[model samples]
Target: MAAQGVFITFEGIDGSGKSTQARRLADHLRAIGRDVVLTREPGGSPGAEEIRRLVLEGDPDRWSAETEILLFTAARRDHLEKTIAPALAAGKAVICDRFADSTRLYQGITRGDLRGVVDQLHALMIGREPDLTFIIDMDPALGLARAKGRNGAEERFEDFGEALQQKMRAGFLDLAREFADRCVVVDGNRGIDAVAADVARLADGRLG
Candidate 1:
């Protein structure tokens, strides 16, 4: 709300097409001559990127929920200071691939009790939230199938398997409902073009 430009973030379980939609939305806005800065977490900023590698490219049990939350918050803080804040201050829309909502959901899944800690840390360290958060909603099974087809070294979280994915999907939907003010649930089961159109239109509406 303090930003001169809009802040938008894409959130969803893996393979829900959130990343693709984020890219398309950024492109759409830029084509219309909007100054847009497209970025992603946990490595949007240089320091954060280093933290991203440490957190992402390791065993599933690499870090405890508490530690993971700290790393994510640190990355987010750096991202905000180095990239997001500067872009918005310069009056450019900041479109992030994944943001705090992902942190809430993922950490929630890893350890239910830590949700409180995550929220507290977020408030203390990273106080800002996106102006609009697009939750690309989709079925867990299908998302898993789509995710499994992709190969990446950052497969630790993906290895949580279908059960955690389902829980994460539900958690995202619940967040959308809980934070209906800024969160919009976009149907991710549809074609990419259709989904992108909806996301772009919604974002454009906010740009007003």
Candidate 2:
């Protein structure tokens, strides 16, 4: 059967420009006369947006790994029901800045077991998988530096030490390996236009 709509997710460590590229891809698709919805994880729907603020801004010291995972799942459930599923059902391509893979990487690093976290999220998702995922791979040190240069209020996760950031980077790579067929790891060290071009090509290929 033909797909109802194409779902593409972008993922990466902080400063990897996943959000920027995701937006670029959405614009490119719209330019080509495709219906598209551009959104993000943990905050696409109203209910999910509340959860997102709590998860991102709440006290990190008080959050346990288990609690973090469950909160992420809760937000994802709402996002799926209120944003993703509807768009796909209507035949609009959905380009998400981050999604399930973010949970896998962030929670896996915090929990110390990539496979277990992936399994739990997969079960929670009930088979809703992205048609394609682009992992904007970036060096941890460089990424963190870039993130710091952005000069924004630090979220709880952003306050994590260098070691934790490195672990998260590793977690993302591990996830890409485990889901090799669906994941494309794009090097993110290039200029924005160059990176956007690569993402545009990928989206164009799928939407063609």
Candidate 3:
């Protein structure tokens, strides 16, 4: 039988470059003959993608914070079942752009007292965690500026602005500390290539 696959996830503020790094690392792994499945949260699978549109698009206040959290959890469950599980069972390394960390931070900041609820829902519906998670650390101002430069239909979360971005960054850093066993903090305030290279190096270490 093939060996168990490696699961890696990227987490950070909206524009911390985690997505790009995730792609770069996937490419690096594939170039070295490693089977890789690159995907993203909230939309990796078909059902989850539809949920993503509902939760990310439309009025910022379309759904209450609590409802939004439920939507995210359902979408995550779908992503896990339909995309992540099958890929891993096939012994293919999976690199996801974002995961439950985003939900924790977003819900924690939005709902204020929902952190415990977030944890409970995650454990109940999606108990699995990535083998390695890279939290791209960077200044919120820089990240927000980067996000603004690439405004898209998903501006719902970015509308929180710099203040919320700062809070989210702190949340991700705190998660890195709390889950140090599988979380790595990569400095992401530099240029894209530099950050991608650093992430790739760290991921390579994990693979070996």
TM-score of each model, in listed order: 0.96, 0.92, 0.96
What is the model-wide C-alpha lDDT for candidate 2?
0.81
lDDT of 2 at 208: 69
What's the CA error at residue 133 for candidate 3, in Å?
0.3
Candidate 2 clash pair list: none
Separately for all candidates shown, the number of backbone clashes (residues 3 or more apart, or on different chains) is 0, 0, 0
Best by lDDT: 1
| lDDT at position 1, candidate 2 | 10
- State how far residue 178 of model 2 sits from its true place (Å): 1.5
Off by more than 4 A, model 1: 1-3
TM-score of 2: 0.92
Worst 10 residues of 2 by lDDT: 108-117
Ranking by lDDT, best first?
A: 1, 3, 2
* Per-residue C-alpha lDDT of model 3 across residues 14-128, encoded as one tens digit per residue: 8899999999999899999989999998889999999999988877678887887899999999999998999999899989989988888888554477888888999999999
lDDT of 1 by residue, 1-208 (tens): 4348889999998899988998999899889988889999998999999999998887888988888999999999999999999999988899999999988989855456678888898899888989999999999999988987888888878887899898898899899998999999999999999999999888878766
Worst ten in a row by lDDT for model 1: 108-117
